[model samples]
Target: MRAFDLAASAKAAAQAAVDAAAPDLVALSHRLHAHPELGFAEERACGWLGEQLTEHGFTVTAGVGELPTAFVAERGEGPLVLGICAEYDALPGIGHACGHNVIASAAVTAALALGAVADDLGVTVRVLGTPAEENGGGKVLMLERGVFAGVHAAMMVHPSPRERLDPTCLARAQLHVEYDGRAAHASACPEDGVNAADALTVAQVAIGLLRQHMTPDQRVHGITTTGGQVPNVIPEHTEADYYVRAATLAGVTDLEERVRDCFRAGAVATRSRLTLSSTSPAYSEFRHDPGLLAAYERNALVAGREFPTVTAEDDRQAGSTDMANVSLAIPSIQPLVSIDSGDVGLHQAEFAAYAARPAADRALLEGGLAMAWTCVDAALDEGLRARLLAGATAGG
Candidate 1:
């Protein structure tokens, strides 16, 4: 079959499959949205996804990485292994504000749609249940455990304020800082005790000052998790959580050193001892395969969606993801699908409401069909596949 004919056939098959399953997919997305789990604690979400895939005839493997929330479901046999990644974990306190429910539903829909045409397309479809993307770096951990060792390509659609292809994601590192000091009576022996809270304040000031000298792409943000016990007593200890980001991994590493030095300066000025530790896996900048991304954009346009061109002005708002880590290792694309996010952006209550709206529901189907069609194109289009492989190998 001609490439266009194959794309149309694959799209038709994907649409049929998605239309037949739309109700259940939307319901699952809503259910997950209602009961959000954080990070590696997504037991119920993971179980439900596994059950859904198994019911659809995919061979399901649960708990692949000593993590209760991680699993893999596969169907068909072929040399090309196409992975559709699912992230079901929600943000702490904010629930599905990140629209992970949409992510899970879209991935499941794509895998099932691809599974329906796997035999004819000569491709193997693997749906990965990657948990804790908001915190634990489940994909990074799974990659380390060889979960994605043989995968040829990976794809996942994220819900955002707008649609874009191969958008740049920053490299990020998270840190937890603790300050130790001596406690004393506030009104009596205040001079005898060192204040941990003072150390944290000093650090914040230092970080704020350091921002003036950093690049425009660099980001430094943090919060104090602890301050004190009582008004009358000087706190003996305090803690703060921070995230440092840069345009690339190498830049982030260099920036991290400077941030650490600021924290040390805070500790020294406040006469408090400080300890800094990483809270999760460091996120790398996305290494987009232009060849694959172009295919994705084509498929998306065919699905009645248009991708907006990113410009310099819009660069400040992009967030980091473990998918960036996957991109560094293999061919990958992380495109955003608009879902009526309204004026509210990610990590907010209003955005969570949009995750279940009709617009989001439509995105689930369109995004899934687009992804399935892209997979079919990749497997059947020798020229595209060769270009993708060459790009990935050269980058490595």
Candidate 2:
């Protein structure tokens, strides 16, 4: 039988610790929301989060995995190492629209709470300052470079419009396509110009048509970053960024090849030079640990967070994240913590406005506490701990 008494005691201690740090945690969330930074450029957010972790007695490593903005904070010397991921990178143009501010603060809160009883529970808590979830795949790079070498399991809570125990996280790849062609005045010597913009248009049209034959779960979306220098001049160079997503990494890779053909077709038709490159490593599908997810669901429910009934058809929360990459390597979970921004979805300017509100603050605290409590439960459950430890050893 599990040591219910010890778990209860440790949970109380964790709750008290989080409650004591509530004001500071909420402030941190608001501060990050106020100063939104883009992926791989989160200098201020990284420094501020590191400072908070340092103040709470974690050994903070400023840079890890060759990423200047990525860091790892650790506390305790227990046998089972638990990783709590913190994502502070904001979306470009939308600014904090994805609510990474809440993610970072909640991670800090979980780290502090777990730190309070780490020794008692025989659990070493690790807080990973993961950057570039919005663009560069920071966690994917870090995982490849051994930043998560000793972590037995990992988890993080992402802010959303509704509470979900396990959100649909797809495997995704970012592709940057560039086209180069001869430039000429629109009216003067127009025949001498090779329109790069036309190449881009052809590629887009192909992609649009390709969508019809694609599987229901597959997604292909992109934006034109550059079209032309001036309307009066034929475009000499054009560039676009695209994301191809599917149910699995292998599936995405296959889909990526087909997508590349579309871009190549554009070049063939317009006789423009085309260059294709990946901006970051492809993210993998999430594999959530059932035990951890169940523990978190119970804890979240007890914290007064409700998961409204919704069928998969009605749920539009399917998205891509670097956290999914981490989940593939370690037993992990990324639960969706609701900010109560009804009808205001993620990546919207209106959602950014709600990220710093009272509702979001409440979700931050509740999510953190649930994560901490789940950690306590994991530490107290000897069977789960042994399994995680065994997996870590085997993985090593």
Candidate 3:
């Protein structure tokens, strides 16, 4: 067989293997969806993923990077190290509404399928259990600790309302602001109190006005956690959480400085002491490697999946993810896999329900097979691999 024919055949075999593992994969996905854990607290999800990989003959190492929820599983050996990134952290209250269960299962399925033909493909497969993507920068921490050291390329499929090869994800910076003031009875001696709530109001108004000068793609929003204990008394202290995003990390840094200035202005305007802290490191923008994306798009099409053509308007509405940080370090793809969750958007209770439904199960299987085939194509096609490496290195 010619090289392309060999790759096609290997991909076919991998898809068949994934089909055979469909039942187990679906069950695992449902289990994870049913018991959603948030961010750094995904201990149960991490253990389950490690056990599944271990059972599938991959050497599993739990607690990677001193993180209780992080793990690394490896199989095969060769110069090309293919990384399958898995995320299991759910949203705080709505749970697996973002379909992390699908992500976790897809990674496992792809790793197993690729491992079955790793020897012939001449590549290594590593399944990385990266937690806390919703809040803490788990992958960023792992990257800093040398967890991804030798991986040639990394890949993961994120569940979304639509299927797309490359959706623009914004760089993000999270801020925590606290304002301190003096308390007094609301109706009595109100003049003696410095209102922290007034400080937050000032900051919010400034942010609203700042939006007029920002790029249309920029997003600045936040919630006040503690406006006041009671309406009868002035609030002695108030806190708020804000997330500011931009098209790139440098843009995010600049926007963040302006946001801090707004907070400082609020302090000055309200006579309250303001303190600002970053809750997490900034998440960078995603860098797309066209060669790798083309391979993935081909594999996805063969697996009966089609991605929609996204336009500038689509780019205007973007979300932030730590996966962007991974793209900066290595060749990575974070394509969206649709779950047919209706109008119920991510981080909603209804979407969480769909995450365990039959449609989601099908998405898990198809996404896994497609990602596995993409890896095979990458390893079997030398030109494409070199292009991906070059693109990643140049972008880095």
lDDT of each residue in 1-396, candidate 2, tens digit only: 258988888888888988899999999999999899998899999999999989989999988999999999999999999999999999878899999999999999899989978988898999999999989999999999999998998999988988888888889999999999999988978999999999999999999999998997799999999999788899999999999999899999999999999999999999999999999999998888898998999998987789887777434457899998888789999999889998999899999998999999999999999999999888887777888888742233
Error of 3 at 250 (Å): 1.2
| Candidate 2 residue pairs in backbone clash | none
Question: Against the unseen true structure, what C-alpha lDDT does each candidate score?
Answer: 0.88, 0.91, 0.88
Ranking by lDDT: 2, 1, 3
Model 1: how far is 41 from its true place, Å? 0.3
- Per-residue lDDT for 270-325 in model 3, tens only? 89999999888789999876667888898888887877778776676689888889
Which structure is stronger by TM-score: 2 or 3? 2
Model 2: per-residue Cα lDDT at residue 212 = 92
Local accuracy of candidate 1 as per-residue lDDT tens digits, 1-396:
786787678778888998899899999999999999999989999999999999998999999988788999999887678899999999877899999999999999899889988877777899999999988789999999999977888999999888888666999999999999999999998998999999988888888999889998899998888999899999889998999999998999999999999999889998999999999999999987776788789888988787677877456687999999998888889999989675688899889989999999989888988899889889878876665545454344
Q: What is the lDDT of residue 389 in candidate 1?
A: 44
- Best candidate according to TM-score: 2
TM-scores vs. true structure, each candidate: 0.96, 0.97, 0.96
Q: Which ranges in model 3 have alpha carbons more than 4 Å from their true place?
A: 311-313, 387-396
* Candidate 1 vs candidate 2, TM-score winner: 2
